[model samples]
Target: MKNIGQRLLEERRRLGYSQQYLARAGGVSAHEQRQYEQGEDLPRADYLAQLAAHGVDVVYVVTGKRSTVINISRDQAQTLMDNRVVGQEVTLDGPPEEDLYFKLSDPSGPPPDQS
Candidate 1:
């Protein structure tokens, strides 16, 4: 299984978001975002709040499990349509549903070390 860092990197890539773009959205420096993706540091609650606001799948990042919110690229959507895998072009309104936005924004960071 990939680590948190790898998942973070994957999410960023999936969204086609540059580190700088996420940095601005998350209110962190690019260096900090890099460090988080490098597993040198974990993201905090407030930082995640910003990410959730900007549509980062924070649940997948921290837990390694993806939420139901699937953000497909236009080409992929088109391909699905071409293959008849998807019936009817449904126009989605509003933001893609994110799982547990409340939870991701709750914990201040990784749980405090008990030991």
Candidate 2:
């Protein structure tokens, strides 16, 4: 089995995320992230949970075979799809459901009203 550090390093590289950037996203210091990636240390459970939220499964990071299960219920998947909007914020007239269209927003960047 590959080491946890090696797996994390590979995944991070695959995602094109630098240690500093990932650290910021995971709410850790860059130095700590580097240490974990370099096989010099392991993060705490809370840190691992944060990584899992970012799509890094702890079992895969540990054993390198993706032994973790990624089971999203139908309702959860629908909720996720319903909430997702690219390059814009959405406001719904009611709860998320089928035929839920989005209200595109500016994303608060770039020139306004260019679309």
Candidate 3:
């Protein structure tokens, strides 16, 4: 399993962010960012929260597993798949729009046959 620093570094690279840029965005110094990426230091809660606000999956960075919750109806699921967006912003509280909600909720099988 990758260490937390490795995961953070990978995520930053995946987003095409330089350590300096990520540090600025996360409100940390570039040296601090390097330390975090090198596993010489761990980020504080505020820094992690800042990263999350900038679209970093801090949970995955820390745990090496992405956290996901699925619970949509069939129709909603189909709609979600049909209109899938790569980096769409998702609201997690209430039910999603019909399509997005379904996709997130249901994991039954292939989408219904469309003839």
The candidate that achieves the highest lDDT relative to the unseen native structure? 3
Candidate 1 lDDT, 1-115, residue by residue in tens: 8888888888889999999998888899999999989999988889887887777788888899877665565555556556764566654235444332112233466777899
The runs of at least 3 residues in candidate 2 whose Cα sits more than 4 Å from the true structure, single-residue gaps closed, are 71-115
Number of the candidate with higher lDDT, 1 or 2: 1
How many clashing pairs per prediction, in order? 0, 0, 5
lDDT of 2 by residue, 1-115 (tens): 5677888888788778888877887788999999988889987778877876666666777666654364554566556656776556544354444433233444686675856
State the C-alpha lDDT per candidate.
0.76, 0.71, 0.79
Better model by TM-score, 1 or 2?
1
**Of 2 and 3, the candidate ranking higher by lDDT:** 3
Q: Which ten residues in a row have the lowest lDDT in candidate 2?
A: 97-106
